[model samples]
Target chain A: MAKAHVYITYKNGVLDPQGEAVKDALSSLGFQGVGDVRVGKYIEIEVEKSAPDEIRGEVEKMCQELLANPVIEDFRVEIPNGNNNPQPPKSEA
Target chain B: MAKAHVYITYKNGVLDPQGEAVKDALSSLGFQGVGDVRVGKYIEIEVEKSAPDEIRGEVEKMCQELLANPVIEDFRVEIPNGNNNPQPPKSEA
Candidate 1:
């Protein structure tokens, strides 16, 4: 199987209200010395096949068609190791 | 200089309403084959120093202070190369 890691973030020069809200909330909770908060989105998808070209097409389609709001958000997709077979690291637990 | 990358997502076993909303939005936009959609937050911070222990402490403080919602979101902090000098890959453009 192949995995696609997608990151969606607000375009540069745009103000992020959600990030500001979170920052305010944090300050109220007594966390000081923190500044400049920016928030973005991350998604991971697993596909049954491992072809880079095909996966790239699918991921681009996915991002354009549904994953991102192209108007305000820019997205980046990563395919680890050229193989499309990416897995989350195992935990010792 | 040092950098901190923080990722925040809904806690396991929690329902991700935003993901569901996005999935529905995608379907309405005519995208098929996307079965699941989960949304999370990603943040990168640039700090003035590169000391590992001090940077770790600062990052934890930042996450606990304003970057994530401890009530509903779980977070992970990554210190790239143990030096806090992580940078985005350069683009050929």
Candidate 2:
């Protein structure tokens, strides 16, 4: 199994109203130092029984085809070696 | 100046329907090896002339108060040393 962590963010020139809203909210909340705020997406994908490189490629394709808006966003996919396998559910207690 | 990168993700027990939808879309597109998919938010906040620790603290408050739903999401904040400063706008030419 392999896990791909994808991050998608608006390109520099794109207007991000949500981010702006958050920034304004923060200022109203008294964080006067706050400046630029950009909001984006993070996705975790697990691929069963696949090579790390293969999982990386698939994630990139997914981001391009469905996960990100190519016209306004940029995406990055990260696959950690050896730690790529999905972990067994951890016990809470 | 400081920059805080905040990642907000669904808590373990929360249902992520959007993630499931993405998984189904991938399967339909023929990526059988794909398994669990989880989606979240990534936010970047720039704070002017603030200590790194102060920025981190402010981001946590921002996440709890506005950027994330405390009942269903968990957030993490990262403030990289030196890179904490907001980048100067770059010229295309």
Candidate 3:
């Protein structure tokens, strides 16, 4: 199996009201130094294994057609270690 | 400045109707081999630079207090390079 992590975010010129609200809320809550806070979609997909390039092509098509709004959003797909289960975040010191 | 990427996803066992709907849609769209699909939040925060550890502590608090729902979601904070702008995804072969 393979897993793809797709991050869909607003295009640079797009205004994100939700992100602005979150930033303002953070400032009110007294979290100083917070600059810009932008929210986006993170999608995790698992599929039967295929050639890495084939999987990438399938995911790119998925994003273009259904996963992202092409006019206002941009998506990046990362397929980590193509044949393994998703890994947990590494523990920090 | 420093940037943080926070990924928030439903805890194990929580039903993700949106994810399920996306999976069904993918199937209907004739995308074969697509298995489990989970949709989550991807948040990007830019802040004035600080010590790495201090920044991590602040981010953890942000997640606990505002960014994520403690009861239903788990978040992972990634501090990439600590003091640079967000990087574009690397080009694939």
Candidate 4:
């Protein structure tokens, strides 16, 4: 089994109104000096009995076709342990 | 500047129909053996000149107050270097 993690965000040039609203909310709530707040979607897929590369390809297709809006959004996929763990260990060896 | 990565997903036991729909869509598209497809949100907040721990606290409050729904959704925050670098190095040094 392989798990694919997908992150979908607006293209850099695209304006994200939702993110702007959230920023305003934060400022109002007394979070000082917040710079930019951008929101996106994160999706996880568990593909059974498929190679990591195959799962990656399938998920990328899904992202292009439905998971993200190509006109304004950009998406990325990562297969955990295939290089995406972003968190530190509980204890160093 | 500090960048914070936030991942928000449905709490365990919560129904994720969007994820289910996507799973069915994948099946229709002929990708076989896809299992447990789940969807969530990814948010990035850029805060200027703050300590890692302080940024963590602010983001957590933001998550609770507006970013994520405390009822059905759960959220987590990661300060890039505070311990999340899941990707392997480009070259073994």
| Candidate that would win on DockQ | 3
Candidate 2 colliding pairs? none
* Candidate 2 structure quality by residue, lDDT tens digits, B1-93: 667788888888789999999999988888777888999998989988567767766677777777888778888777866334543211111
Error of 4 at A66 (Å): 2.0
Which has the better DockQ: candidate 2, or candidate 4? 4
Chain A (candidate 3) TM-score to true chain A: 0.83
lDDT of candidate 4 over A1-93, digit per residue (tens): 778889888877789999999999989988888999999989988887467677777777777676788777877888877855453211111
Residues A1-93, candidate 1: write the lDDT tens digits.
677677777777779997787667766876555566667888766555568877766776778777778877777777866654544322111
Model 1: how far residue A51 lies from native, Å? 1.9
Provide the clashing-pair count of each candidate structure: 1, 0, 0, 3
Off by over 4 Å in 3: A82-93, B83-93
| Tens-digit per-residue lDDT, B1-93, candidate 1 | 566667777776779988788767767876556566678878766555567777777777766655667777777777777854544322111
DockQ of every model listed?
0.29, 0.62, 0.64, 0.63
- Candidate 3's error at B55, in angstroms? 1.4
User: lDDT of each structure?
Assistant: 0.69, 0.78, 0.81, 0.80
Query: Ten residues in a row with the worst lDDT in model 2 chain A?
Result: A84-93
Candidate 3 lDDT by residue in tens digits, A38-62: 9999999987866766776788788
Q: What is the Å distance of residue B91 in model 3 from its true position? A: 33
Off by over 4 Å in 1: A21-35, A80-93, B28-30, B80-93
Clashing pairs in 4: A85-B86, A86-B84, A86-B86
CA lDDT for candidate 4: 0.80
Comparing 1 and 2 on TM-score, the stronger one:
2
